[model samples]
Target chain A: MKLLTLNFLTCAIKTCKTNSASFPLHPRDAELEIVEADVNLPFLKNILPRLMWDELRGICTELGLPELPATPPTPADLIQPSSSTPETTDAAPIAEADEEPSQTAKDLHRVLLETCIQEGKLVCGACEHEYAVKEGVANFLLPGHLV
Target chain B: MPNPSTPAQTYETNHVHTVYEEIASHFSSTRYKPWPIVQTFLQTQPQGSIGADIGCGNGKYLRDKSQVWMVGCDRSTNLAKIASKNEPHSVIVADTLALPHPNGVFDFAICIAVIHHLSTAARRVEAVKCVLDLLRRPCSSSSSSTSIFTSSATPSGPGGGGGDDEGGKALIYVWALEQKDSRRGWDEGHEQDVMVPWVLKQKKEKQEKGRRKKGGDEEVGAEETKQEGDKTFLRYYHLYRKGELESDIEQAGGVVLESGYEKDNWWAIARLR
Candidate 1:
């Protein structure tokens, strides 16, 4: 599963819906793989406001990845500065496609989209129920009793 | 026939889940075409909006739009495996009643040709509630003020006034019980709960060679022959009547924003009340 999906997923158990600790499922013994994908600049910009930055940073830390900045990146930070004009200009043309993705955008894409959990167990902190991930698909179907 | 006292889950397990697992590949091959209503709903979402596809068989709708992100989930492991191949999106094995998504966070959702599989009326309504619960709740100020007017007005188009400020909406479709002109000829008075047969043809050497030479369409034509080796699987369905979907939505604490019949199916766009 992509790390980005973990942002919205929680424990499937009915009782865990209201539990705070179940929101960010902790990845344990994860086998990470980088499946390269083209970075979607607009998606990154639009999704910026919705991302739970602290929770995402915590997941990255748990996976032993590089630390992220405390604050989330702004939409403007995702775009590269205009190469034609080296100096700041008071009036800039409103051309969105002309702008290139900055390094920040690429790194964000790498962590959220490219990074995959090839194999692992996502443990819910509240109930300690573990959902297994194998071959990139997380099995969230709880047993009959648990449901 | 299953005993009347059997639980809905167990009945569905035998009649629905197991059959899909066995026929997943053949079923996916036949389901490549996206229904027009479903296609339009997916196309209208704003870019970067996140959504879920509950009971997303073969993940055909996932291919409709690239701008919006959608995560699909299915009960069958085999179908989920096939659906996971849709890039930039994810698929997980999950039951409709027990979705793993956080409540009221998604921008939109689409459940097509799925809820009809639930064997009972109560389970069907619960399934609708589960999908609605995944959507982001409307802003308090706008919802209370605008809901009265919107409900009284004519049915809006996809994403009409119900976008961002109003809240996330889910477009749900189910097999309708009023298709007398169709091949099956089921009408309003026909049995609602019935087992639909899906015949799987066993590949014989002679037929395989013929299929390769002729084309894909030849296999569908050959279905009429009823070869001895062909295995038929019976899947359960609860066809919905007119206005039934709207009633279920209301019972589930959802407001039906818009609804109409499309190609022998009843579809409605709804949001949590």
Candidate 2:
């Protein structure tokens, strides 16, 4: 299997292990932030409430950080998204008469987040096989023994 | 990503924009008019410049321009396929929510008709932020793709409602835009009806009824109301007002060059800061 098969796995394992063992306490930053989701997905900023406390905390812990508080903020608290939202969309056709009756700003916010993140998914752009971005980075390089 | 309609899905790609493009083009010529925006840029875009079309449905804006290296990204793959078939100007298939390109590579970028329909606040705002991120550069950048469009500089093009200056020149901004929408009419004889969004029968009937109610014979305004063949698609559009547009651009680190609204449409030009 292509180590590329474990691209993100490689990144996560690499991150979990230390560089030269001398910098064990150094913060494990994931490779250049995953830019594939919504390249345009904005950073969670001042005005919106916090989103995805658990997932974000998990991501932080995966990179060796303290977990987040159990209670997370909401749009009312203006937490900007630290991670891109998942990507999912509804393509159902809409009749013009059904137009203006849809959703609230908050509801729309959740939907947008759903569209940006590809949680637990690491797809092979070359082969379309689904892998996992377990710890943040995708390690596609499989070892010879595994292959 | 699997189709959003599938059950037990972990990921979904945007499919509406692609279908929307096809449906829009069936009646109107194009879902978005890119030539004016791109041509305006190319005539001035810098060398080795990396630019992006944020909601580049089919990458039309960057299509066929060899000089300025460009990337085209959208939130929808189906729509990107159409852009690939019809335009194919972009080098990558990536999402605008998180552009795959490295930072500060582009000197300029464009996001056309992408925000209003964003369906989410974060993605919408992020689209502009990506522009900000990409436009950031190494010291003094020297890369300014700045242009000015004054009222006098704004070409009337064909039928922009200006003096007939074409007495000496050809034309520009000649394309006409048609807004398309559908209203389902109840057919009492049938229990169910499926009307394609492409069909504008309701519009035809409404216009005909209005014409008849006015006793027909309104030749004066008919010429002005005539649908031009240049318009080739069913248009579904949402426009931002001047203030709304300015705030979004500025918040995303850009200064407006100029903005103009004509023929019930909104247009603006800006330089990324």
Which one wins on DockQ? 1
Give the worst 10-residue stretch by lDDT in candidate 2 chain A.
A1-10
- Model 2 root-mean-square deviation: 22.9
- The C-alpha local distance difference test score for the whole of candidate 2 amounts to 0.36
Structural similarity to truth (TM-score) of each candidate: 0.88, 0.40
Q: Itemize residue pairs with steric clashes in candidate 1.
A: none
By summed lDDT, the worst window of 10 consecutive residues in model 1 chain A runs over A86-95
Could you give the DockQ of candidate 2?
0.02
Query: Could you give candidate 2's per-residue lDDT for residues B1-273 as a string of tens digits?
Result: 323332211111222344454443222222334445446655464333345666665455655543443445555444554554322133233444444444444445666655555443344455566555555342332432211111232221111223321111001111112212211222224222121133322234445445445331212112224353422222222334435555666776666666654332345555555
Q: What's model 1's lDDT at B55? A: 94
Name the runs in model 2 displaced over 4 angstroms: A1-147, B2-18, B21-37, B85-88, B120-122, B138-238, B271-273
